[model samples]
Target: MPSETKNDRIFPVSPEKNDTQNIELDLLLQAVFLKYGYDFRNYSKAHLKRRINQRLNISNLETISELQNKILWDKEFFRLFLKDLSINVTEMFRDPDFYAAFREKVVSVLKTYAHIKVWHAGCATGEEVYSLAIILKEENLLARTQIYATDINKSVLETAKQGIYSKKEMELYERNYKEAGGKGELSNYYTSKYGSVLFDKSLSKNIVFADHNLVTDGVFAEVHLIFCRNVLIYFDKLLQNKVLGLFSDSLAKRGFLCLGTKESLKFTDYENKFQAVDKKMRIYKKLYIPK
Candidate 1:
């Protein structure tokens, strides 16, 4: 009595599908959030795709779905995947102009504070962390200041704590230190051993390296200065605004916030809350906007 449909049609029907890799990728991110509690949902989609594809290639998996399955089931694979996604790209005295500007403009203000707190958010591998320490040491503020360096990736945090780096890297680091207005040779802080350099243990005497995800974590300290450079470019606008708000809450009155040369407070909702200390170098001072 009922008319035969595709079941009785001449050609056999293939399974119905709308399987785009992007869809699978979104699902993968959602699964990761639910299963692991690491929020990568709002990261730049293009960046996520590229990094995920790289993982796919390395794992010999054919699709994002396959990679997602492995990531959910295998803890080790998830660690490697997190490392790939969090991509720690950093160097000591990166963009020497920023450090030089900080020394000139920010150090004088910091000297006024008897006890100072500094937060280095998204400190990858601690290159810049030690760079700041060197500056504070030269300025005689290291003894009075507490430096808190945080990164989302635990592996990088561990590496940052060790404070070891390749000798080859020191060549560029030394040049940068001098350009950033170092008074003495950068080598004075570290000893060479087996083609590597071990930085002075005393440099980290006041530094606290910890795992803190700006995405998932709340404000951890009220500080005199915050250095978060080259870390926001990877986040989307929403994430950027969210993290910027966190920074606003964490900074003390008239505290300074330093970003990468390419990053700025312009176009952000809190742009009005900060006045540029060095607009060209991307340093800003929090304003006392009456609530």
Candidate 2:
């Protein structure tokens, strides 16, 4: 053997270094899990890579190792990365057609339930929470309902609790509301101040905004309906199945599960466990008895 160096890539370090990078990624996931308990280990490799690249760019890191080093040293960086990883990318009534179908099909059945518990999982900035609130209010069920709005991003959670959005965004949201079959004036929900829309404080009376990570946390409450839209796409197949498992367990008997327009349980192992209540709306009702 002759003198070798780390940069040699063959003499001291193996020329085939893919295994080393994989081991590094494994260790990084283990470290993050053990430290913050926000599990991203099973998330989709493509999405994770995208998010990781975004984080690295924002942090000005030269390599994944550099990002990992910063994450280990700066807890704040970890939180920021989590925000980049989990925050929903859009506005209220994200898909108006979905809401319209939901109102027509699901709300009718929802009215039959004496009381309701709705969970808006990965509810970034609370727009969907308010949307659901409006629907429930119109249906005369808001007074007897409990809404749990959860997300992994603490910063977004705070914003969701505040329920303040820019006037411009509110304008678009109002349009979305109207198109989604809103029963009353969208202006009734919020007041304008400083060029922004501040939603009525009363709307959130029955709502709870809390930090909940689908990746690692267990179900906090059993719910009559779970609206976990656009969140599972961030997760890999294994993680998607795990999160769906938690949802299946969390939903009450004969409950509803709503996913994003692009997502479905068809390929998931849970397909047979849920029946399509609104095919186009991506809404499914859980089976009362598993076949």
Candidate 3:
């Protein structure tokens, strides 16, 4: 006997059911883009599915259609949904080896520049932003550097601008700082209050926190260095290429670009545009071919 069930009832699943769900998901993404300005159309479908399913479970919604209806009708609910889609998993001095390589290989080249402009794309909550600031300060380059740290989520940007983090995170951050070849104590960079730590205001003096979407936004600035680690993995191949093109256009000739350990420029349209500086750290320098 063929039966259809709802609300946790055991029923025979059909291929048609999966097709319908995919269509519903597509419609929901389209609705989000039309209603809000955010574009998630080209995002990785697998990543989208996991995040959407998690939101559904959290909101106790039965279907993607139902979720879409709430998102469209309730502005506050959409804000919550946007947070779910945003990737905010970041820590100070993440991948210590990458920072070590940056200090060893990239910092020396940056010294030659009179003024440095850095773009930290997808800089969620600004932990790594401050980490870079601390490095620059130690290397005597902070005074001449201006870092633009941008993210799509305004809520996270607000948190980033405040530069406050839970004190509980300091132990791990301190350990990461030491491993990243810190010249002095990590504790010198922040002050503790109640249960949170506020990073030194000087660390953020040259940083500008702004809302920028990598999916739909164009070239932000002609930067000397770009740190967009662990961000491209969430995008599909097409979006990855599009964003890489934007980065390639945004970077100055002979500028440096740093990606996550798992991310790379291989098989992309911009592969030949960059030469690897530290392949293991996913660092690359733009080629200086004459135009």
TM-score of each: 0.93, 0.90, 0.95
User: How many clashing residue pairs appear in each of the predictions shown?
Assistant: 0, 1, 0
Which candidate has the top score in TM-score?
A: 3
CA RMSD of each candidate after superposition: 8.8, 6.4, 3.7
Please give, for residues 1-291, the per-residue lDDT of candidate 2 as tens digits. 655533233211343544555566667777888887878888776666566666655566645777778778899888777776775686888899999999998998888988899999999988888988888888888998999999888888898899898898877888899999998888998999999888888889999999888877898988999998898887888888999999999999989999999999977999999999988789999999955
What global local distance difference test value does model 1 have? Answer: 0.91
Q: How far is candidate 2 from the true structure (C-alpha RMSD, Å)?
A: 6.4
How far off is residue 17 in model 3, in Å? 3.1
In the range 5-106, model 3's lDDT, one tens digit per residue, is 342322114668657778998999999999998899999888887788778766777778999999999999999999999999999999999999999999
Off by over 4 Å in 1: 1-19
Q: Which residue ranges in model 2 land beyond 4 Å of their true spot? A: 1-24
Candidate 1 vs candidate 2, TM-score winner? 1
lDDT of 1 by residue, 65-183 (tens): 88888989999989999999995889999999999999999999999999999999999899999999999999999999999999999989998999999999999999999999998
**Model 3 misplacement above 4 A:** 1-15
- Scored by CA lDDT, what does every candidate get? 0.91, 0.84, 0.92
